[model samples]
Target: MKNIRNFSIIAHIDHGKSTLADRIIQECGAVSERELTKQMMDTMDIEKERGITIKAQSVRLDYVKDGEHYILNLIDTPGHVDFSYEVSKSLASSDGALLIVDAAQGVEAQTIANVYLAMDNNLELIPVINKIDLPAADPIKVAEEIETSIGIDATDAVLVSAKTGVGIRELIDAIVERIPAPSGDPKATTKAIIYDSWFDPYLGALALVRVFDGEIKKNQLVKLMSNNEEHQVLDLMYPHPLKRQKTNAIKSGEIGIVVLGLKDVSIVNVGDTITDAKNPTAEPALKYEPAKPFVFAGLYPIDTDKFEELRDALNKLKLNDSSLSYEPETSIALGFGFRVGFLGMLHMEVIKERLEREFDLDLIATAPSVVYHVYLTNGDMVEVQNPSELPSVSQIEKIEEPYVKATVITPSEYLGNVITLLISKRGMQDKMTYLNEDRVMLEYSLPMNEIVVDFYDKLKSISKGYASFDYEPIDFKEGNLVKLDVKVAGEVVDALSIIVPITSAESRGRALVKNMKEIIPRQLFEVAVQASIGSRVIARETVKSMGKNVTAKCYGGDITRKRKLLEKQKEGKKRMKSIGKVNLPQEAFMSVLKMD
Candidate 1:
């Protein structure tokens, strides 16, 4: 175990985490040159196209240092705040981490957040300055910034260009010399932590685990600590870039994949402990806590009959993304659907897109909302995920919405714009500091609801994409909030209902109705798109009826005859308006996101 080094690569979004991972894999000769591609660890097409990492991946490497063979287990993690839970879980499985910082960008909000996470895990950190090949690169300045802001010694920080493969050899040598190897007893009872699990059609569910105590061998019956269930290990393999390398046993201080040949992925939960069923360990290998979802949205199939298919898809997807939670729900506007909980907006988007692309399903996702705490007059409290699920006004006492502590790092020139944007989102200043004369870091407390929709986009736009943001949920606080119900032709569209702060209810209602008017297709009769609170309509917009000239045939008739035909047409429209069902295009449901 002395020659074994396990480490995770972490960084802010677009700070070369994945590229650095690719470079390291190349340097260690994990994959052949003919098979290697960019972002080798990122297997998803969406991740490739978007230039982002949505999932965490691990690979075992063999390296020869000074004529000694060394085993290096490297885990590549996502840099986006939405996938930070993946980073945390990956960190928990590692003994050290490589903190990658952009040479020109210096430190970012997510960098600080990830540093804190590493500190909490007590992992040895090696600061690495990437993008040194760029013309504007400032490795020395970034190293200083890391030491000042992150309070880590950066004098020996590695300077590498992940794109051009500079300093990669030195970085690997630093890892071998500095990061501590895994320490556990190979003779102890079998104990392992399942860091990740996903479904495989041919192999059933596969768990990628780190062995902490004993060894996991083929045909060994193991018990899951999360549940007292026993399953024999059908196969064991070391994770690799192109194909898994078969192994007979996974000894202590090693990471490998265990196949139990079970169809149900839930049984192999991430963070669960696997121990020898006959001589099980006394306790779990690590203390595990499930991920908590912060945002909620409704996902409905366009074809109601495919509801069961959607459920099946969700179950399969849950195996890949365990953070996702869903429950059955029905809406007047939309038929049977599932109310899904997500970690953040990006996560919601990725899941929806993946469902559409991979499962071949047409889905409509309602406006994302945060969980709200509704207290009743009788002193009963209920948690509300869907706005339409809110109790009647008469039964409610007060409403509390979740809040988050947001950290933003931006250049000084955009400080005014950033502050204005935050304040407009009902943010309260918490603290502020200057990372240097030109860059500033601002902290704010903002309602979770405000940031769930388009805050990140706005922040990026106002700052010209020079700022980085990250947030963590703090607690729920009471707020003067109201539910805004949207009505189409006198019928409430429960799917479009949203909870908003009482202060901006009027403007939000107006903007929503206005946006809806543009997206709602014109019907044979006029449709009144109204935003209301209870019985009071706050804003209304009319989607004008499609004109049909009934008097065209009587062009030469008397004026009274033409007038009579027009009157009949008006009466027909009035009758149709009462019963005509509006076919809300998918864009109408998504219009809620564009209501600025």
Candidate 2:
């Protein structure tokens, strides 16, 4: 039998996990030069455009070394905190993980968080300190830190560079030896987990799965446990880095593709386990939960007319990302905007960037929100998705909000500043230790809702984007912050803003109106923008039109140019907001840029 191995690469955000993934697939002899592109696992346009692995991807490579064929099942996982649930699911299909760390940055908080997940999954850990060829790399120090922090001996940590292909061979050799071989009963029952999948405009739904046990064959009947959907597997194939080729079926230890699943990509659960219905196995499915959506906001288009178009784009995106949830929501104050939930603030930005960059859409978003539990006097339990629904203390029995255990790793010089900033964000330090002479690591217990909103971005800004932080859900605690009312045009707009400390009511109101002013268009007629805290105006601004200042003006032989300009402006006015008879372009809504 050919030697079979299953593994995955886990690391912090931007630590070259996807890049290392490409190198491993190539070394497996699955893909070739002409057939390969950068970060092949990140096959989606949004994934490539954003430089983040949004989904977990599995690829099969056939390696021939010393005249022996080695079947390698490689699962590429998302490194960002946003996709923790998906990463945990990817671990379910793997027997070991290559903990790729940036040698220069040493061990980061995300690295530690992922390590804990791997340990929880009972997956073997192989520390592979990547980017060793970088100028700032201190392999020895990183090895020592890994030993001290992860409790994994540093002696076996391999120094490798996913960029230059350095130490790749040794890394592969270690995989062939250290990682355990597949031993599950191939004939017991069919079970596999869909690590990641995509919808082909041509091929339908293509799913990449790692067979945990039994076997899956082309044209065989299969069932998706999450939704209980059954389908006939139309085809099966393995990764041909150079060219795709059809495979008959894959055994328990193999990883490959399945198609004609019929169900939409969203129905295919990433962390969900699959098994044969007739001979179902009792093995508990891999223990992993979906990444919690922390950040909340509204998404709207510059041309409210194209609101449907933007919704379609998001629907297409959500087909692949089941974790992203929303419903048709209208804001009496801000007009119609969907209340979006995200894993974190970066997750929110990534969504915005994709909407703008990939689909070529313009969008405006409100401040993010954290989920809150509201308990009523009648014993009714409600999970408040929007901050505006928070019941007053007098009306509620109690409230609970999500909490997290967080860790921050940064240079020693910024230790004091980091702590001050974290404390300001309602983070309480539990432990602080020096990693070496130049670095210090701090562990804290914080509200998950905080970090998922703007805590990550704020921390990076305060630390010059040098500090790395990672967190896992700890528990829930009652919060003291109250929801700030954002009213426009003298009406309460619940979706216009969020929950904030009493002291920040003014600043939050100011920021919201500022963003609206910047994004709201300049109408022909003047429009007043007032950001108030419960009828108290914190800031006010007015958008005044140009008032046909350049209308019908022509001198010399410039008539043709002016006519073209007027025609273009007319089309633009059609796309902009209209107040009375005046046309307001989309850009007028955003007034903060002018202030900046």
Candidate 3:
């Protein structure tokens, strides 16, 4: 029998996931008053810079009660909707989950999502309605709402102010009581879940696992069940990478790190299951499935000439993150650009930010487009990622659309208004609950097709930024939405358009084109920016004028400063790919591009 337990802390965005982690670590004696960074789990520069958890992080805490210590393995996961797949994978590794619903916000989309994932994994779920110390907190109502909605009794839900460390003791006790201790024969073959994995400059590749069954120690031969690949373990450790926690063995349900320096670290993927080869365990590792990228955009180096460098940078990015999907694609009009796929818009933005921060390379992007299903003749089914590739009316049979399951949380007074807004957006209510007399829960099944353009911005606007929602691809249904393709200089730019509602096509395209105009940097030549509905251009922007004349009259200013200035200008110009006399800038493409 094992005394240790493993649990994950999951919640909606900004629900204090990192904060609660801090208090838990402190209580476990992992850190002292003088030894902790703010949001220690978020150690990555990108994570701290964005104020979000982009990766799943693991930590081990030794909790003492009456002089008896119970080691608890705690893994913190990204709470954003974009990282839902990562959340699901992390949940797969845990025996239970701590659903940290915000007291003031009650349950948002991710709250429902993380809970659903835990239930699906068949893991024990202990709801920790957090932020109780906040003046706006309403733990009682949150518990009631959770019970009424998910059918999980929140009657005993632990209320905690993770920030103030209030009620943390109770929360820890609840974890030990609610979650099952790790089980299975310690002498048998080992099987573990890769909670998180990343590349290390010195160590090569590192994999963090919670041994669900048997034992794994240094010199043990293990196989990844998913790929049927064998690796010889060279070392073993616990928790943080900085420490070399060499252990002879890890028994069933013990969380630890295993290193296999012999194998190519690149193949050791996160979410993979590692098991001992001897006394083979019949049960395979837990399923590892990456989320499909919903948002599509074009990635082009601004220095139009550094195409190879851009590709290499993306390759390096893919090595670190398994989520990014990219394909070699080109625009006859825009020249060379990559069709990069992302889980969502937030994901795209995060990737852009990372590239800018890390690569120091300028990138240009077009607008994001939704995945479209175009039924063709001869019983052929096609998924159109770019609008310019949409089948002509002759080739297309019936078009199907993607949908999202959304949850809306707001004040009771705003309930009617929120529903009205969703109804207008062609969303159907799936479920509802009363958080309190003053707050309500509203669930809706919204079409993903409708949300392809400006739906998120509109949702924030209508709810006055008080509401939070998330969605996953549910099913495809017949819809009236059609693809609007943008054409620049008579050449169709596939990355420049999106699939949107017929009613708002012209208006949305017009507004987007306006945003694109503001975002797209000026070029050496007068370039045209256009948003088109199919082949017809609905909106267009013409560069007003160029400040410089083609003839440089070649002799002015200090020779050295001018030479330095020319060198800098040349280097800057090289960062952007020049297409048809236009030098595209990275800023123009990263956030708001007219291309895909």
Candidate 4:
């Protein structure tokens, strides 16, 4: 245990966390130089393409220091704010963290957030300034900023270039010397924390756990503390960047993977405690709160016949991602589908992409919305997850929308633009401080709905990609909110509904109809695309029918004959308008996502 070091790498997105992991793995001889891949810790293809870590991964490394062998368990974590819960879980399972900061970029919003999380977990911190190979590298200034903003001693911070493999050996040495070894009793009852899990077609659900007390061996009957369900450990294995190595048992202060051989993946939950079923411990390893989603969206298959396939895919995905939650729902425009909840917009995007790519199903996702609390005049409160389910304006007295406390770090040059953008989103300034002479940290409280849309993208655009943003749920606050419904040819399209503030309902409705007009194809008859708050339509656009000259067939006919033909054609159009159903393309539903 004294020679074992368990730690995680935490940083903002694109700060070389994954790259640093690759360098360390190479330096420790975990894998040969020829076998090493860029960002080895990021195993998912999507992660590599996006240059970000979406899932947490762990690896066991054997490092020889001064002729003494050491066991190093390094966990790689996602850097996006959407995956903060995953970061917390990784931190909980580690004894220390390597705080990676981009030397040129200095500290970011997510960096501060992750630092606080690591501090809360009581993990030893090793600050490492990465990207020193860049021409604009400023390690000295960055170290000073970290000390001033995070209040951590940066004099001992490790300076390294992850891309160039510089100072990697020094960083590894720091990990072995600074990070404390895991402390637990091998003789005590079994107690392990399941930080991550995944589904295997033949082996069933595999749980990635950190053993805190006692030892977990093959064929041991272990109970999940979350539900007190017992499952015999079919096998044990140590995680590797390239592959997993089989192990007979994993002792205290060690991290390993346990195979339960249970076909039902739902039974294996992350953040659950594992203990000996026969000799149960007095308490679980630790208390961990389940992840809560902040954004809600509907995922419907383009072909309704594939709904079941999508469900199965989601279930299989859920086995690995416990944060994903969904329920069956029916849409008038979209047909049968599931209303899925996600941690954030990026989370939603990742899930949608996975479902489409992994399951090979074409899916349409509705506009993301935040859960609203509706307090009706009847003294009853209801939670509205879907905008279409919102009560009528007459049925409700007050409506409350979830708000978030957002933290933004930006250069002083873009301070004006950042503030203006926040104010436009109905943000209330909470506090502001200067992190340095040119960098400012601004705090604001804004509606989650505003942030759920394209707020992050807008922030980056306004700041010219020089700013970083992070947010946390604050609380539900009363707002003059109303459900905005989009109607196609006098019928409401439930899938295109959204909740918006009354002040912007008219303008947003106008935009929705305008975008819909551009996307909805022309029918045989004129179609009225209307946006309504209730029975009253606030905005409308017309999709005119393709012109037809019925009178041309009777070029020289009498006036009475032409009039009769015209009346007949008019009557036919009226009937067609009544029965004509508009077949909107997938792009029409997506248009709502772009509504300002």
Candidate 5:
């Protein structure tokens, strides 16, 4: 236990955290160079294609220093804000963290956010400057920025190029020297905290846990602290990048996989404690709160017959990803579906893509919305997750929308453009500070709904990809919010409804109707696309009827004959307009996502 080092790599997205992990693994001789692959920690294809780590992975390595053999357990964490919960859990199981900052980009928004998380966990921090091989790499400037902004000593920061394996030996040596070894008692009763879990068809549910006290061996009876469910441990193995090595037992201050022979993955919950069933301890391991979702949206199948399949898919996915939550819901325009909640827009996109790719199901996702507190006139409070479920104005008193404290880090050259972008999104400046002469950090309070859509994309565009953003939910505040509904030919399209601030509802509605007119195919009769707020139409667009010149049949006919034909055609059009039904394409349901 004294020679065991548990640590995790934390950094902002695209900062080469995964590459660093690969290099460290290679340096530790965990795998040979010929067998090694780029981003070995990223096991998912989506992660490789997107160049991001979606899941947290763990690996154990053996390193010898000064003739002393040591066990190094490294947890590779996701860098995106959406996956912060994973990072927190990884930190909970570690004694220290390797803070990797890009050499050129310096400290980014996520870097700052993750630093606070590590500090909150009281984990020792080791600063590491990555990508030193880049032509524009400036390790000195980044180290200075870290010292000034994070108030951490970075003079001795490890400088390395993960791609070329330069300075990897020095980083390993630093890890062995700087990170404190895990402290626990092997003689105590078994108590372990599960940081992550997944379903295995052959072995049933498997839990990845860090043993804090005592030992767990094969065929031992164990209990889950969360639900008090008891099961026999069928097997144990050490976690590796490529394969799991069978172990007779896992001792204190070590990470390993536990198999209970349970087919249902829900039985093995993440963040739950595992203890001896017969000789249980009085106190369980430290409990960690699950990640709460910030955005909610409805996912309906394009084919209504797949509702049950969709439900099964979500259930299976939840077994692997505990953060995903869904409940059965039905829409008037769209048939039966589920109202799914996600951490952010990227999280939602990943889930949707997974469902389509893994389960082979086509899905239609409604516009994402934030949770709103509705104070009814009848002295009742209701939480609204779907815009179509918003109560009528007559039944409500006031609406409160969720807000977030957002932090934006960028170069000083784009400070003006960033401020303008935030202000347009109804953001109020909360604070501002200069990390140095070239970098600025700005804080703002913005409504969650405003930033939940295309805020990140727009911010990146305006700042020319030099700005990074991160936000956390704050308390809900009273806002002049209204439910904007779209009516196509006098019928409300529930899927196209949204909640918007009163000030921007008119413009948003007009833009939505204009986009609808361009995308919605014209019918035989004129179609009216109207945007309304509480039965009052605010914007309208008319899709002209597909016309056929009635007078063309009689080009040289008399004036009276032409007049009669024109009148007949007019009457026919009026009848068609009354009875025609618009067949909206899938693009119509997705228009709201692209609406500015």
Candidate 6:
């Protein structure tokens, strides 16, 4: 146990954390050179294509230091703010962490946020400067910035280029010398925390755990502390990149995978505690708290008959991604669908894409919205996730929307543009600090609704892809808000409804109706598209009817005969317009997002 080190790699997106992880695994000789791959820790196809880590992965490594064998358990964590929950769980299972900073770009918003999470877990941190081979690399300046901004002693910060494999040997030595080994009683009752869980087709549900006390052996009956359910451990194995190695027992202070031979992954929930059923421990290793979703959106199959297939796909996907939550809902415009909850916009995008690719289903996602707290005149409050669910304006007293503390770090040149963007999104400045001569960190309190749309994309574009942003939910605050509903040819489409602040409701309604006019197909009769707030219409657009030659056959007839034919055609159009149904294309549903 003294030679064992349990740690995780933490950094901002595109800061060489994944590259550093690849280098470390190579140095430890975990995989052969012929089979080694880039971003080995990121297993998903979407992750590889996008160059991002969506899920946290772990691997065990063996190293020889000074002629002594050492065991290292390394957890590679996601850097995006959406997957911070994954980082928190990974940090909880680690005794130390390696903080990687880009030599060209010093501390970032996510870097500071993750540092706080590591600090809360009381994990030892090792600062490492990466990308030192780049022409713009400045390790000394970054070290000083880390010291001032993060308040960490970076005098001994390791300088290494993860891309070129420099300083890897010395970094491994530092991990062995600095990071403390796991400490727990091997003779005590079995106690371990399930840091991660996933479903396997052949093996059923598997849990990656860190044993704190005693040992978990094959065929042992273990009880889950969260639900008091017991299951027999069918197998035990240590984690690796290419393949997992079989093991008979997982001793204390070690990380390994436990197989329960169950079909459901929910039974082996993440953050849950596992202990011996007969010799139960007095307390759990860690308290379990499931992730809370902040964004809600409706996902509907393009083919309404495939609703059941969508449900089945969701269930299977949930086995792999436990953060996803959904419930059955029906929309008048889109028919039967599910109202899904997501951690953020990126998470919602990834899940939607996965369902379409993995299950071979066509899906349409509604505009994402945040949870709203609506207070009634009778002193009662109701939570609203969908715009259609909001009570009538006459019955409601006030509405409050969720807000978050947004942190942005950008170059000095983009400070004005970043501030302007934030202000346009209804963000209130909180504080600003100068991290260095050329970088500034700005903090603001922004509504969660604004961030869920296209805030990240706009930020990246405005900053020229040189800024990093992170946010945490703060609280709900009262706002002058109203529910905006869309009417197509006199019928309300529930799926097109959205909530907007009263101050900007008029402009938003105008923009929405104008965008919808271009998407709604022209029918034989004129279609009136209207946007309204309760009973008042704020904006309206007309899709002119397709012209037809009603009097073309009457060549030399009297003028009165032509007039009679036109009159008859007008009457028929009036009747058709009353009973006509508009078929809204997928683009019409997505038009809500394009509303500027």
Which parts of model 6 have CA positions greater than 4 angstroms off?
Answer: 550-565
TM-score for predicted model 2 compared with the true structure: 0.84
Clashes of each: 0, 15, 19, 0, 0, 0
Q: Candidate 4 — what's its lDDT?
A: 0.93
> Could you tell which candidate, 5 or 6, scores higher by TM-score?
6
Collision pairs in model 4? none
- List ranges where model 2 is wrong by over 4 Å: 34-36, 46-50, 240-242, 261-267, 277-288, 301-316, 333-337, 355-363, 375-381, 391-400, 510-528, 535-596
Worst 10 residues of 3 by lDDT: 587-596
Candidate 3 has an lDDT of: 0.75
Looking at model 1, the pairs that clash are: none
lDDT of 3 by residue, 1-596 (tens): 45688889999889999999998888877877787778888877988887999887887778877677798989999998888877887788788889888898777767887888998889998888888988988788788888876779888889899888999999999888889986666766777877676665577677778787778878888888777888888888888523446787767888787777732645776777788776567876676777688888887776768788787677667656678888988876467868999888788888877787787887777777777788888689999887777777667787887787777777777677788878888889898877657767777888775565566666678778777777777888877666766443344555555677778778767776666567656664455677776567888876543455322655666677666766765555455324444434444443333322
For model 2, the run of ten residues with the poorest summed lDDT: 587-596
Quote each prediction's TM-score: 0.98, 0.84, 0.86, 0.98, 0.95, 0.97
lDDT for position 344 in model 5: 94
Which candidate order results from sorting by TM-score in descending order? 1, 4, 6, 5, 3, 2
RMSD values for the candidates in order, in angstroms, are 1.1, 6.6, 6.7, 1.4, 2.2, 1.5
By TM-score, the better pick of 1 and 3 is 1
lDDT of 4 by residue, 84-122 (tens): 999999999999999999999999999999999999999
Q: For candidate 2, write residues 1-596 as lDDT tens digits.
A: 23998888899989899899888877766666777689888866878887989777777676776777787778888988778867777787788989988898888888888998899878888899999889999899999999887889879888889999999989988888788886677777888777666566777777777787788888787777777777788888885434567889878878787886454555666656667666666763564465567767778776678778787677767756657877766654446667788877667777788778767887777656677777778798788877666676567786778878888999887788889878877788899888789888898988765565556766788788789988777777877665665443344555554665566666766776666665656665455567654445777766554456455566667677888878877666555434243233333323322221
lDDT of 2 at 516: 65
* Candidate 3: regions farther than 4 A off: 241-244, 262-266, 304-320, 333-337, 430-433, 489-491, 512-531, 534-542, 545-580, 586-596
Which lDDT tens digits does candidate 5 get at residues 146-190? 998899999999999999999999999999899998988899999
Q: Global lDDT for candidate 2? A: 0.74
